[model samples]
Target chain A: MDYVEELKKDFRYIEGLNACINCGVCTAICPAAEVSEYDPRQIVDTVQHADNDEIEMLLKGDTIWYCGECLSCKTRCPRGNTPCYIIQSLRSLSIETGLFIESIQGRKQLALKRTIGEHMLKYGYCVYIDEIDTEMFPEQGPVWEWLRDNREQILTRLGASYRQEKSGALRKIPEESMKALQSIFDVTGATERFKKIEELSEKKAREMKISFNSGKDDYFRHLYEGHND
Target chain B: MRYSRNEVWETYQKEIADNNFYFARSCIRQNVLPAAEDLFLKIIGTDLGKNIYDDARQTTCTGIAYHSGIIPFETTMTVVAHLFALMNEAGYENYACSCVTSFGIYSEVLETWKHFPEKEKEAREALKKATGKTFEIPKNLVHASDLIYKFRKEIANRSKYRLTDTTSGLPLKVVDHIGCHYAKIFPEKGIGGAEFPYVLAGLIDEWGGQQVDYPERRHCCGFGFRQYLLKSNRGYSVANSKKKFESMKPYKPDLIIANCPGCSFFLDRWQYVIAEMENTTYGENGYGIPVLTYEELAGLLLGYDPWDIGLQTHQVAVEPILDKLGINYNPDMKYKGAGNSNTDSPEQPSSIKMF
Candidate 1:
């Protein structure tokens, strides 16, 4: 894939970078850079030099994945550079080029695709209470278990009409709204992106010998279970 | 408007429409802190006598997916366009978002459209073709907390409870976790400047709490949409949280108030995770610091019932702080519902004690 061409497609990424004197202040303030091997300065370094191979290597590797996108670098850059914006474009380029399929982030896309990506279309929420199981997230404690069991009652008491047709917070999202949401996803090309994520992740899952099924299957569990530190 | 990082806000100034608001509900905030939106509606719509429309017809900003890189910018922009179209159809111009991510995403998308006018055209065509609706860009867009900060003195005057714990009779030591998107990205839009955002701090001071500024004050709450969504990469999320907890542990804050739904959820839940991982606690005793959305705190200050606000659903037990505040709540209310019916007994019930 022509990684530089993909990066060039994003004007925001080009504008985000100012004259980087390479002072390394952004990397110094970056928490991801601190805890992980990700360095914003180096990513910027590769961008300025137009190093295609280095940029390709970045797309296929985890260094680009390591940005938390906190934009702390945006906050402290002496040259007014926006490393986080560059990171965003790189991520987009990675996905567009299918280079994301080669990295850990690429594999993790399936998890996000299923949980957040699908959850929104299905329930109109990114994080729904019913989907969060106590077994997977034991940190919620048994009180959450009780709340899960008594959802309608608790949510009602809190003044939200949970799953109800009436218009209030937590009400069952309207049918047309859901359809419009799906249409937005479709017309805007995000659905295609979601499908690509599914296709690529399925292949990756097969390579790992992890069978993929509908929900929380072997590969899904593996991704949900987490990856190497 | 040259939004320089060097600007210091001596007086708060921005285009915050005072009335006729279109309130956008947050997906996470509703699930985690349902009563927050309820209380916000109560305070603004009823108490303050403002006409705020929180239509159920509006959908999620799809921000979680967008920020996680599953959804691209153009897609999210189209989604934003649709939402704005809905708001425009409803005859509301002022947009107040309940979620920080939603607020930030709206701002970011609008800015992106501003930079790339053709993209805005595409989004408009997409929305108009799909929904048969047209939109005018909002005259004002602000977070719900920004409204609260704008009306802090009014809320202070109307509030039934102060920040002082009723039992201890001491002022609450508060830690405000301002979401990164709120200020870090665009400091000009944020209340005060990014470095010393007084969004939560100003409210805390007005409401009678002592704001504690720790070393890691500006740290993200580790809800890296991408990092945290993938379970294996959560260590990165926790590492950032660990940094904040370690830095704030010295302050021994009584309550944590945050504007961002994700931050509030992450800070509340990760404290428990961190405790289990490292076998240490950050708050008083072995429990963790109680985290509340700024709206939830506003609800509490307005003398809202603990159970009515769904405090029981919180992973980290709020009972400790409630007890410290001498907030009167029947111990049985944590288990039994109104009128006292039998329910299944759960294992390790943190919200309830067998008293």
Candidate 2:
């Protein structure tokens, strides 16, 4: 849990971390600190004083995850310390330690699955599952009606063809590259996540009132708001 | 039309990315036939086909998964190495992405790879093991836009079009939206001048259009991934768009231009979506502004047919501007604009007094 060494080593960009004057300006301007408890000034103060234990605690804490990596602190850090980047570096360290794994893991998978579902089946950008009501996106609305009327035109313009490309036309993947990707999928559990996303996405698509027979056509039409059902 | 010092430095960084380039294929382009690449080559003078090595074992950066966070750090590292490997194979140290997210991922992965030697080694080993290749970050990496801006004079010189108003002979006014990823990720390296920036605005000016101002020019299109994901407030994106629209509305310029597709998508589509949400009329008499890509706008000034340039694909119509200019356009031009006409008088005389 001694992050001082890691912090010092990882953030070589900040040559003099111990030089922070602790004016609290970094925390004041931090977007994450404003919305969440993650204060960069506090992190800098702890690191500057060599408070290794508190540094570790802060790194593992939820405060680290809330930093949006905006680097507003870096720009205004009168002491030239990049607490924003430091917080980000620490957050990655936390992820490596398996902290916040559960919360972070499946959400991306779910979102991707949803996106692929919308892209593949519905042919539109994936809608927020919570915003599924037709009333919220009234079918007769000008945008909706324009899409409905010009569905084919929109699809054609977007260059979507529901049909999969003929396999051999794509650049052939080197066998080694394929093998490496396969191993990466196994190591990161990305294959399973992709599968889960694909499954959930398909289910959501089925639940929808619309269906497109051509994946390419469907995607383009959906992109342009051509199909309602 | 003038670039600040920071903007100039950002252009230098982008030039670094462009000089040592690694082109990534986009899904949209995969379906549409490499229009992005074609446009890039036309605008920037690099033929990706000629520049990229045939033996280069390039792979998808899997940015889609990275943004979704479905891909773990280890996997992301491997993809990063794959990019470096491509660059290394081509004998180039710098890597650049046509897509904004690709640039962001390159920046993110490069930062992470610097710390974790093991991960970097693993990624290098993965590439070597996979393709009998080794990789390393060159001196720098950058986005294509950065590079394009670097060669502004060259692009302007090569340009085939000249601006002349059919009626008044005034140049067109434009507003620019620098992608959030470009500006936010490497603030020092992204476009400069205005804090928000018109890196592409200078490019427009090079091609004969005058760059104009818009409100909320610095704000992200609310497509900040998290904003869209958390669905915290649809208005967050809309407000950003509204600020931009209101700013440009006064200028009553010909078009709103963007370099990044995501920004274009949001700025182009969200006006109607936001207008519906807020129940307010936008544009002239409730019409929304036309959002264009730097390429499309350049193509327009360069005299490329709007239809051929894919202008018709945009949600907000640009035809009205063409009609206003009295340029003869095909009425059947597949693209249509939102329902509104030019009820306002002819453009006001320039209140702009350049310092």
Shift in Å, residue B137, candidate 1: 0.6
Q: Write the per-residue lDDT of candidate 1 for residues B56-171, one digit (tens) a residue.
A: 88889988888888888888888888888889888988999998888889988888788788889988888777667678899899999999888888889998888887766777
Model 1 DockQ (Cα-based): 0.65
- Tens digits of per-residue lDDT for model 2 on B78-149? 756766766666677556566666666677677656655666777776656544656667576666676666
What is the DockQ of the complex in model 2?
0.16
True contacts kept of 1: 0.71
Instruction: Assess every candidate by TM-score.
Output: 0.94, 0.67
Candidate 1, clashing residue pairs?
A: A226-B232, A227-B232
Poorly placed runs, candidate 1 (over 4 Å): A227-229, B1-9, B166-170, B338-340, B349-355
Query: What TM-score number comes out for model 1?
Result: 0.94
**Strongest candidate by lDDT:** 1
